[model samples]
Structure formats: structure tokens, C-alpha cells
Target: MEHHIYIIPISTEKLEMTEDNHSMTNEFILIGFTDHPDMKTLLFVVFFGIYLVTMVGNLGLVALIYMERRLQTPMYIFLGNLALMDSCCSSAITPKMLQNFFSEDRRISLYECMAQFYFLCLAETTDCFLLAAMAYDRYVAICRPLQYHTLMSKTLCIQMTTGAYIAGHLHSIVQVGLLLRLTFCRSHQINHFFCDVLPLYRLSCVDPYINELMILILSGFVQIFSVTVVLISYFYILFTIFTMKSKEGRGKGLSTCASHFLSVSIFYGSLLFMYIRPNSFNEDDKDIPVAIFYTLVIPLLNPFIYSLRNKEVINVIKKL
Candidate 1:
């Protein structure tokens, strides 16, 4: 009697186990600045403070927008949504990240990771759409002031906000769904603070070509299309502002856009740097700072950026 032996590849074994959801690693150790143990306390304090302020600032703006009858316009509605999404973005990341700073066991379960990434994705994606919507609002207000009210109707504003959320939901769902197909077997240690998709790809035993391609296509399209809208709208706005006979009109136009543009530039710049590149996987050092900027700092800054420069928000605050 002759016996034949067949050996399965280790990668294949890992993939099979992962598919069953009982892989060797059901939890990932988030190696977030753990190397810098001396700085942990300071970092935690700083981030905690930032997180508290971010929540207060963003939610306060939302509340103010809701309460103020004069702020029932299209611009404030978009600003309110932006503030809400910022709060979501900060809340999704900062708590877990802060927890990890002191946690002896910084392991996060698969589902927790998914939830974190989902909310973060949703917030960021919706933010892109919201910014674009705000740009279009500015364009209509500045370029075609005569038709502003007619063009940016309440129904249209609601539809645009609804569309942004719907797109965000779909994008997050698809991305998380794709993550399920990946088999993380190489190492269970996530290099960054959270369960970011790119870091997970680095640990996958299977080729993540499809996942990467989808990110490039979907995220690329979202960023590019939204950015195009912003740029074109701003171009038209600039043309109109410069062509205006009244210095007051030009000043008003620039004032109205300054805050939104600053916010958009910082938000999109960080995003573009983080995701829209081929060698992103190799950029660990650069990634952390950029991620912090977008996920934490941007949210912290946005409320102040929009509010301090605006006459209406200041008046509302004074009345409060």
C-alpha cells in the first residue's frame, strides 16, 4: 500500500481560518505610541482636553444652529451638519485612542475595530460631501445673488444633506464589507492607534489588491469629484468677487468664504496626503501626524474657524 501526502500552504490555512472568523487572531493590539511610554501621560492629558473641547464646540454649534431662528438658512444648515460630522469623527477616534494610552491590554476586537472604522469613514466621507455642498452654496450666494434664494431652496438643501449621508453610509458599508474578506495572519499588531483599513491590509496573508483598488477608486472618486466641485465653485466665486464694482461686495464675498475655504483646505489636504498615494503603506511616521491632524485637530479647529469669523454666530453667542 502506498500513501500520498498533501501539504496545504500556510497562507491558505490562514485564509480558511479567517474566513470562518476563528482565525489565530480575533483581536489586534493597537501599538499606538506605546514605544514612547514617557510621553503617554502628557499625550493622554492633551488629547483628552482636545476631545472634551471638540465635543463641546461641535455640539454647541449644532445646538446654536438649531435654536437660532435667523440661522435657518442653507449656509448654517450645512455648517451644522459639518459640525455634527466633526463631533462624530472626534468621538469615533479619540476615546479609544485615549483609552489605549493607559491600557495595559490595548487589544481591540474585530467588531470594535469595524465599528470604529465605520463611524470614522462615515464622518469623513459625509464631511467631503458637506464641504462641496457648502462651496456650491457659496457659489450661488456670491455668483448669482439675485437667484440665491430660488436656487438654494430648503428642499434642495435637505436633499443635498440627505444625499451626503446616504453616500457616506454606502461607502462605509462597502469598505467594511471588503475588510471581512481579508485574512489578517501575518501579525495581529496594528501599527497605528486604530483599526484603519490600510494598516489591516499590511497584516493580511492574502493579497489585498482588490481592496486597495476599491479604496483608490471609491475614495479617489469621492475626493476628486468633491474637490472639483469646490475648485470650480471657488473659481466662479473669485471671478465674481474681483469683477464686483463695490469694494463692500468683494470684502463680503471673501469674508463669507474665508472660513469654509480654510477648513476645506486643511481637511482635504490631510486626506489627500493620507489616502491618495501609492506608497501609503510605507509612510508610518508621516501617517500618524496626518491622521491626527484630520481626525483630531481638524475637528477641534473647525468650530472656532467657522464661528469666530461669522457675525451671526457671534451674535447668537452674545445673546446666549
Candidate 2:
């Protein structure tokens, strides 16, 4: 009995030490796009060009709206903010991804990972609200033209913008806080290009039931609420446009909403696929491709989508 007691205590101490060692992991290796030498160079050049263009385009749009007095209405205000968030979303993922292309180590520290996800989440969440706001603005303009200025006032625009950021920050803080509770002691290698929440959950030694639940609950609520606002607003705008007596008026309203809805459909479609799903864990292969769309491609496309179809912005560019 005495010998057995000593053996059991010794085993317990060893087990504790092992757990300590596992929990002390401070960094992770990001297994990015490709390992082939030639492919790396090709991908690096392609993505570098993308990153440069994304920055220039988004920042240029923001600058244009800020400098132009004509573009001072609610529509442009929301558009400018959307461009800024797109830049942020690209910056959160692309730079590190580019570096990892040539880096042999491809290592990202745990805290660094947390920061990446926080900014990404903030930009994405803010974008959802911003799109919804833009939809409402369009509805007011097209559906209720007489009270457009009164309904979409400057004060209300600023308030909605502020509210979006507040919600984004709150969501990000809660997500990062939940991440801190997890001890990632299994595999140090993350499967995706960047340290996304889902991939990190797959690495956790602890069961991430609560983390997954929170992601579904929080992300679902944000997306659903924002999407609901957008849908309701657009429904009214559509009805108003069809009821217009003049053909020119109907065409003008359709043209205005077309560009906005195009951007919305692409952005929301990719996001809905990424987050609002039950089997995100098993869909590892699909994650990288879908993430590339929202994180890189959407930002690049938005500038062109909004600008090419906008006569006011085009005239402003021509004047400049």
C-alpha cells in the first residue's frame, strides 16, 4: 500500500509536468500556399501586385471622397468607410501571406496571430453594418426622394458609422478573450495561410465547444441582422422603382442600386459561405480558396465595382 501510494503521486507529478510543457507553446508555423521554389516566386509576384493595387485603389477612393465637396452626402460617406475597411481587411492577411511565400520558417507568434484575427474581424464586422447602412440610404433616396436629406442626415450617418465600429470592437474583444482560454498543445502547424479562429480551434488541446458555439452565435447574429436590414431596404427600393411613372426614373434607380447590390452580393456570399456553416472544421481545403476571395479579391474588386459604374466619381476623376 505504501509503495503504491508513492507510485501514484510520482505519476501525477509527471503528468502535470507534461501538461505544462504542452501549454508553454508560444508560436506557430504557418504552412502557407506552396513549398515549390518556382511556384513561390510566381505567387509572390502575383500577390505583391495585388497588395499594392489594393492599397492604392482603396486609399485613393478614400482620399477622393475626403477632398471632393460634391461627394459629401450619406452615400459617399458610407462608401468611403467601406473602402477603408476593405483596405484594412486586405492588410490584415496579405502582407504576412506575402512574407511567408519566401520565408523558410513561416512562423507566426501566438500574440501576433491574435492581433491578425482581431483586425480582420473588426474590418469584416464593420463592413456588414456599413453595407446595410448603404442599402438603407439608397432606399431613402429612391423610395422616399422628398425626405432623402431629412432621413439620411449627416448626424444619422455619423451615428450609424460609430455604431458599426463599436459593435466590431466588442465582437473582436470577446473573440480574442475566448481565444486566451484555449491551450493549443496539439499541432503547432496551422493549415491555412493566416491564423484564423477556426484553424486555431482545430489546434486546441482543450475542447473548443464554447469557442465554436460563440463564433456561430456571434457571427450568425451579426450577419443575419445586417443582411435582414439590407434585404428589407432593397425590397422597398425595388417596389418604388417599378412603380415609377417615367422610364428614365426607373432606369436611373436601377443603375444606382445595381453597383451597390453587386458588391453586396459578392461580399456577403463569400462571408456567408465562410462563417455561417455547420461543418467549417472539416472544410479545411475549401477555407483557403474562400478566404482568398474575401480577404484579397473582394477588396481589389470593390473599387472598380463602385467607381466604374459611378458617373459622379468618374466626372470628378476627369476634372482632377
The estimated TM-scores of all candidates read 0.93, 0.92
Candidate 2 backbone collisions, by pair: none
Sliding window of 10 residues with minimal summed lDDT for model 1? 17-26
Count of clashes, each model: 0, 0
Candidate 1, residue 120: the lDDT equals 96
Candidate 1 residue-wise lDDT, 200-288, digit = tens: 98899989999999999999999999999999999999999999999998999999999999999999999998998669965676778
Error at 26, model 1, angstroms: 1.2
Stretches of candidate 2 off by over 4 Å are: 1-24, 35-37
* Weakest lDDT window of 10 consecutive positions for candidate 2: 1-10
* Root mean square deviation (Cα) for candidate 1: 4.5
Tell how far residue 97 is off in model 2, in angstroms: 0.8
